[model samples]
Target: MIQLPYPRLNVIFEALRYEALPQQELAQRCDISTRTIRTDISALNDILASYGAQIQHQRGKGYHFDIYDETRFLDIEKQTKKMKSSPRNAKDRMVYLMMRLLSQEEECKLDDLANQWFVSRTSLQADMGEIREQLEQYNLELISKAHCGLRLFGEEQAIRACIAHILFQFKPSDHTFIDVCEYFFPEINQPSLKTDLLELINKNHIKLTDEGLHHLVVYCGVALHRLKQNACIHHVDQPNLSEEAQKTAAELSQTIESLLGAPLPQAEIDYLSIQIAARRVTGVPEIDTQKPTEQLELTQYLLDYVNTHYNYDLRNDEQLKRDLLCHITTMILRVKYQITIPNPLFDHIKRYYPLAYDMTVAAISHWGKHLIPDGEIGYLVMHIGVGLERNFSLEEQLPPKALLVCDSGTSIVRLLESQLIRSLPQLTIEKVESLRDYEELSKVDADFVISTEKVSQKNKPTITVSPIPTSFQLEQVNKLILMNRSHPYMLDKFFDHRYFSVLDEPMTQGEVLKKFSAHFTEDNITPIEFYDSVIERESITSTILGEGIAIPHSLGLLANETKVYTIISPHGVDWGNGKIAHVIFLFAINKDDYEEAMSLYDLFVTFMNGKAVDTILGCHSYDEFQYVAKECWFNRKKDW
Candidate 1:
């Protein structure tokens, strides 16, 4: 019997249980493309044919399993269950290999690992390259001896941190504390261990968040495992912990040492204190006297930076101020001591809160002091995201005001006003005037203008509707109301025909960026150093938002003037890692106009939907692109 690949295991199980599953459903479950699912199904049928079973696909339904000889199929299933349970994907294999090396007392041999996993030594060696790259981020390394083999060489604290991060990667959000302990450290008495730790933590009055408590427990368990192998931290830097944190660490150490039946070194105790200090939530003391001056100043600086750069005046938000004061207290320690805390919601936050994440990144980059890791950045983004949401909610609560300009009789105007009020309850009609009166006014003091006649107003948005508005016309009015709430006027000012291009030929990301950069440089819009900074930013993280869309920009505000260079590639450009970019928006933002950055980022996000990207790609001229983009933006206003 052939050993089943890990990716195919789920497909086979679903086939055996259900009569059929749709191709899209299977692809979603496995987190692969429909094309890849089709390929995997073919391979599975080939393997099953030899065992008197095959997978068949229906036109409307999906894949189904058929077995001719029950005995043969049963044998194959048993063989699959008994096969060696090694990791089958590169990511899992690398993680397993790193854990093995970290836990081993002696050097590990590639040959031994290859044989254990049933892979070639060459493949194992290739994975080692990736492992080394990942370890570099944690300040850990792998050293090879001439004859013995390879062993992990790094600070004991760093090794423990790396181990905690690996374990966190495998922890599901719904997992209980004991469930995690059982999976990572099966030999320990998890129930008793957890009870003891909680008792000590409560006894000492050491406050911790739910995630913080989980991290502390996992770290203690990891320390115990390492100590059993005689691998203990001999030296560590002194951490600036509070009196409460120090006492908690002392008691926690005693509990861990009792479980190990040994005394922990003072260095280990100090390291544990640092971990406790980093995770403990400091209470917001009386703001007038107990808060540290330095922390207050830093928090004020961050708030001011956001206000000046992102146009978010959160300086008066007392709740946001207190939350920042509390979070930054521990965050400073984590940065100073190089502590690594895994954020489980990092991916979700980045996906849904791109504007907040970018603003946070820009703010931190402007701080220009310590190098903050992405994990810490994720936490800061959460605080800023809440502030943004609060501002949006307050804006939404205020009913929008509109001026009615109708060229009908007084009775007709009254009827139209009544109809509008019934349809749009949230709208406040500030004034009702005739067309001649509206045209005679020097300025319109309303959010938008609703007219029954063809009227032109450049200052405020104008929408024309029938004397009695239809459903579609009301929808247009509603969309206009939503758009006015956000005031996303940056689209018209930044995107211009002069800066747009349609590239029919294929190009690399580097080639396209450099070409755009050079053009801007010649036009005196950006310095020559702009291209390098953009490349450095891309190296940090790919700008590809997936689905043939990419928004590449510099590390900081590098352009002399703000402009968006739009590119439409009929033939897709390579954006690294098998991603292609059909619609690229290379952002050239200036510091003076940084307040508009959020709106600009939102515009790119609007194009991230597959349909919007396809519509943009179909346009051949700048005028056509502009019209299609505006339609897409208007249609997606509800998402804002």
Candidate 2:
């Protein structure tokens, strides 16, 4: 029998499941390219020949699984089920090795593991190197003795935390508790344990987010596994807990004891209590007397930092303050204890809310007290993103007003008014007047005029349309409204021909930054410290927003004058982590213009969409750049 790779097997499964699938659809389902799918199908046909089956492809309809011998096909199908159960790649092998080592106290020999997994010892050792790097972040070490092989050496609590982190590391977004538990804890009854834990949490009025609940349940499973091995956390400092928290801890310990059929030690119980407190959602008011002064002060400092640096005055938002207070209080605990709580929506949050994410990163980096992980940063971004949304709503300016002139009767005027309102809600029609009345008016109070007849308005811009406006007319109105907005002014204000450059040579990120910084400093646009600040900001988090685009700015407003240096790297700069930036926008913002510069982020967000960066990269001069940018902006008017 021919052994098919995992991706090829997935393609086969999808083809068999569907009657007929398009090549594009199959590629998307398998997360591969259409070219790869075609190659796989060709290879699969050869392999399936021995099994009395083949994958038939049509021109438009993609691929279909045809079987001539049911017995042979069934044999291969049964083998695929077994193949799916084992580790398929290096990442999966590393996970399997981590779980095996963490679950047992005995030393694991690389040669033995290599034989068991049908791999070379060299390959297993390379995987062990990566595993060691990951474990170091959790304060755990992998120690190897000459004769005894390799063993994991860490505190019992840290070990268990590592176990929980590993289990949730690559968890799918749609994976259930049972799916995760059954894979990681095959010997334990996870369904029963989950039921007992859920009931106990409800009975005790314990507040945990769905994510928090999942974390607690998985921690309990790890605890049970360690306790069964007679390896327990001992001699740890008892955390300071409130009276209510102590009672809840006692109840939780009892529930665990009943499930384990053994009494937990005081140290283990204290550790468990700390976990619960870390994960628990507090219901205390924002101004509760028990609220820690340090956390409140830190939260206030964060808000002030964003307001001063980013020109977003969220300091006065009471709800934002409350949310930040609650989240930061627990976040500090998680950071202090090195606990890992995965943020499942971190990617989505970062992608959709780049400005908010960048603001959160900058604010936290300015705080400079703790080395907060990306997961915690993601949670902070959510809070700050909502606060920004609230601020935008409250301070949003009114739409452009337009006057309507129709030659028809009252019925036609009414119909045009309704149609215009439905199509362009952002546009306000001040009044409706006939062409003669519009001509007779001395002064028009509206910004623009929309008319059904071809009439000229000297004061305001006039747009001619049918009584019933077509889609093109509506689009023209929308484009006009968007142009009247801050987008065009923003483009002209920051981007300039003097500051734009096209680099055809290959360079590193540092070289590009240094070159841009030198030019700015020599021109007296920015201070010498600007380069260091930009480097510091990048060190905290790379400003790359993906899709061959990067918006690099300093830690604070360090420029003498606000300007944006645009660089188009045709050969691509080697950004760290294997990312390449084909278009770079280095912002040098001054403190005086910081308030008006807030709209700059929106312009960058617009360019981050589909093919906008590519279109901008293709520009050879400032004129071309400006044209392509305005085109991109006009196309994405609805996003604003």
Candidate 3:
């Protein structure tokens, strides 16, 4: 396996994720000089060639990765992933240095560190300054000794938390050790530490996030090293721990003591309990698990808000409630200690799970205020989002069924039903009867009604086909089956020509939002309160999804009726957070029309995921916008 410097490897990996990028664009995104990027690419290719992968350069399109043998390429990826080595970039290096400092029991001299990294002492000092700033976030500081080196000094709890937070940020392979001490100093690595930790977790039936589990294991290893040097955690006002967590912590301490062949102190046990309590798993809360009055009240408030606005029956979801309570409990401790956990998946979460992300933003605004940042909100989104996904999955698996109506004999009807079943594995034949049997029936009770004769049952969808359906008939049936599986009707009514507008000039997000919303207010299409809610929602988090599309919608139903307003800017406008959005969707829905709002949102997401955005960007007229949307919706692939 080959290793590139910290950020250089990271930058190359990022560049490989895209199709192609211009040299200037690549350099700007990586925050490096073009010459440095070129040199790095050359060096990276030399390493990649060994794994049957090469970074290819186009004349003017920048660099892209070409893999000649996927198996070999993946092998290298796996090896590199297991190593989890530090990137050579400045930010990663600072994090690496901090991890090294946190894991050490003694001061590390500046010259020694510089010599180890083959860097000048002055350069190392600059990195230390950055590390100092990061430590200050946790209320920790770097103390320099006259004849000695620098050492980190702070509250014992804060130092432990800093170590946990730093280790948690890096994702290690399943079989690999997540211990920083192991990464920096292999001789100090305890191979049995992870094995013993897992055994303790399993014996006590402890469950935690993968990252949480890794952090706890690494923290325990470092704590053991420090405690051996007589650096024990002092007493502090501790947060309450659950009975189950207390037991788990005791078992963990016993396991560690056994592994090290030493008797653990009471202070170590208490510290372990504190760490365990801070990351209690997401499960049914124990009967005696205590919750702070204010946080519990806020949890109820948020649940009610979600229920009232989205009409989701989440109140009965014990897992969601328990998860939220545990998360908030941990959050309070993090806030009090000024401990920040950086979420590496923030961008991906914001982009892929906008609705969940939006709901999280609302919750943060209502409860967190200065306490929660975007990173924490992202984790909250994952918890709530999983519940919502489960709900949708249940809806999709209700079974696709079809009603068969033919003026033929019973044998022919059975043959048609069998052929239909054979063609569509997911489809179930609900009814097989003659035309007379069909006419006597009051209604159709299936996903789609397949009749030889043309029968229209108002809102019910019916397809006409021969007794022995042709290939084209099967295609139509397939399309109808897909249509039936889509969300509740009212998609077409959501978007209207009356609400669509083409801007004469590019405007800021605020200007576009205000201008489009005022039209609704003036026409009595929406209430005055609606405008305020939309703007407030935008302020909570920018709705920009990049690639020139922004969806701004209020959480509550303040509009007089459900409506979607499309405002297009030929030149993209700044939608905050360095995003320039050309397409803006102003969605206003009534309280009872939540279903329609969600359906419209799904369509918009699909549209943005396809080539429709390109067509939309090329459009000069409102008619073109509508046409592009129509084409995209019909051709869009089902991702959800």
Point to the candidate with the largest lDDT: 2
lDDT (10s digit) by residue, model 1, range 200-319 = 778888888766777777788889988988889998878567887888889889988998999999999998899898988887754543645656876788788878765678888878
Preferred candidate (TM-score higher): 1 or 3: 1
- Encode model 3's per-residue lDDT on 352-398: one tens digit a residue: 78877776687668764455767778888888888787665444357
Q: What is the per-residue lDDT of model 2 for residues 99-175, given as tens digits with 9 covering 90 to 100? A: 77787679989888788767788988887777888788878888889988888888887888788888767543422
Any runs in candidate 2 off by more than 4 Å, and if so which?
1-80, 120-122, 170-184, 258-261, 286-292, 392-480, 638-640
Better of 1 and 2 by lDDT: 2
C-alpha lDDT (0 to 100) for residue 470 of candidate 2? 95
How close is every model to the real structure, measured as TM-score?
0.77, 0.78, 0.63
Question: Which regions of candidate 3 are displaced past 4 Å?
Answer: 1-86, 97-137, 140-154, 174-187, 202-211, 224-232, 242-244, 247-268, 280-299, 316-353, 368-492, 496-535, 546-548, 567-582, 637-640
For model 1, the run of ten residues with the poorest summed lDDT: 172-181
| Candidate of highest TM-score | 2
Write down the RMSD of all candidates, one decimal each: 5.8, 6.6, 9.3
Cα displacement (angstroms), candidate 1, residue 627, comes to: 4.3
Decoy 2 TM-score against native: 0.78
lDDT of 3: 0.71
